[model samples]
Target: MTHLLYGDRLHLRPCQIDDLDFLHKLWNDPDIRRFLFDDRIISREEAQSFVDLSIKSFKSGYGLWLFFERQSDLVAGFAGLLDFSQEAPSLIFGTNPLLWGRDYATEAASVVLRYAFDTLKRDRVIADVDEPNAASIRVLEKLGMSPARRTIVNERPLLYYEIRDRVGN
Candidate 1:
């Protein structure tokens, strides 16, 4: 059976094909796409490929996880490690716009970070943020990640932050 992860107020499970609709809607939400996809709409097929990748990633000890509020059983967002084939996995997460400011992103991400470090035994993890996204910067900071570098993607400035597992835990 697939494992379930929990936080103080949320529960997370590996994403599956059945979640395609929810993911597509989340990815296409105007506020979300602006920061996550540079305002471009993700096609249904593209979203399906994402689920497919998650399935493969799970076999490798990491993948996307869908998180839901414990009380409501409502999907608040998604979080997971990405792009580890080429290098260390980078963190990625998003919360429902209506649920913004409640720190759901940070909450979900914190669980994923632990999975990466404590469970998967990764030495470090990183995240890429759009330069103008202060909220995400705050989320990464709250997770104890620090700026690693800066670059441009699609002509937009981007910031890369990283965190390493210290000697203890």
Candidate 2:
């Protein structure tokens, strides 16, 4: 697997074809899907398609990753930059419900944010969190991102957070 970024407790790597099973398990978790799109359970075929599409997107330097625990190498969840547009992008991240409340999301997101600004040289990055998802809001704030705007996604109100590259100071 291709390692994208690593933190003290987690390492983010590209999702491999063999990761379908793990991805399926993560996506199907009830709590994991709670803040996501309607708690939809995706089929194996859908999971495969998602992985394939993500792989294709990775080639262009935009896609999600299979977040792994650095100590045990257990698949925790997915995290990375999602391409919202050529000029605008969003930070994508989530963890298995079992791993919730452990700060893994914050750790992984912090590393990716550094990669976005320092490595990719992106001017800014944004994240849309469901208004009621307190955990997600905390993660964004922990990474130095501040509320930028509010918008509706899929008929649900969402809060957008943003962080920009700080080249000096």
Stretches off by above 4 angstroms in model 2 are 1-3
Candidate 2's displacement at residue 130, Å, is 0.7
**Cα deviation of 57 in candidate 2 (Å)?**
1.7
Query: What tens digits encode model 1's per-residue C-alpha lDDT throughout 1-169?
Result: 4758999999999999999999999999998998998989999999999889988988887789999999999999999997844668989999999999899999999999988889888888989999998999999999999998999989999999999987535
Q: What TM-score should be assigned to candidate 1?
A: 0.96
TM-score of each candidate structure, all chains considered together: 0.96, 0.90
lDDT of 2 by residue, 3-43 (tens): 47788988888887898998888778888777765578889
On a 0 to 100 scale, what is the lDDT of residue 151 in model 1? 96
Q: Which pairs in model 1 have colliding backbones? A: none
Candidate 2 — what's its lDDT? 0.83
Question: How close to the true structure is residue 100 of candidate 2, measured as C-alpha lDDT?
Answer: 83
Evaluate all candidate structures by whole-model CA lDDT and list the values in order: 0.92, 0.83
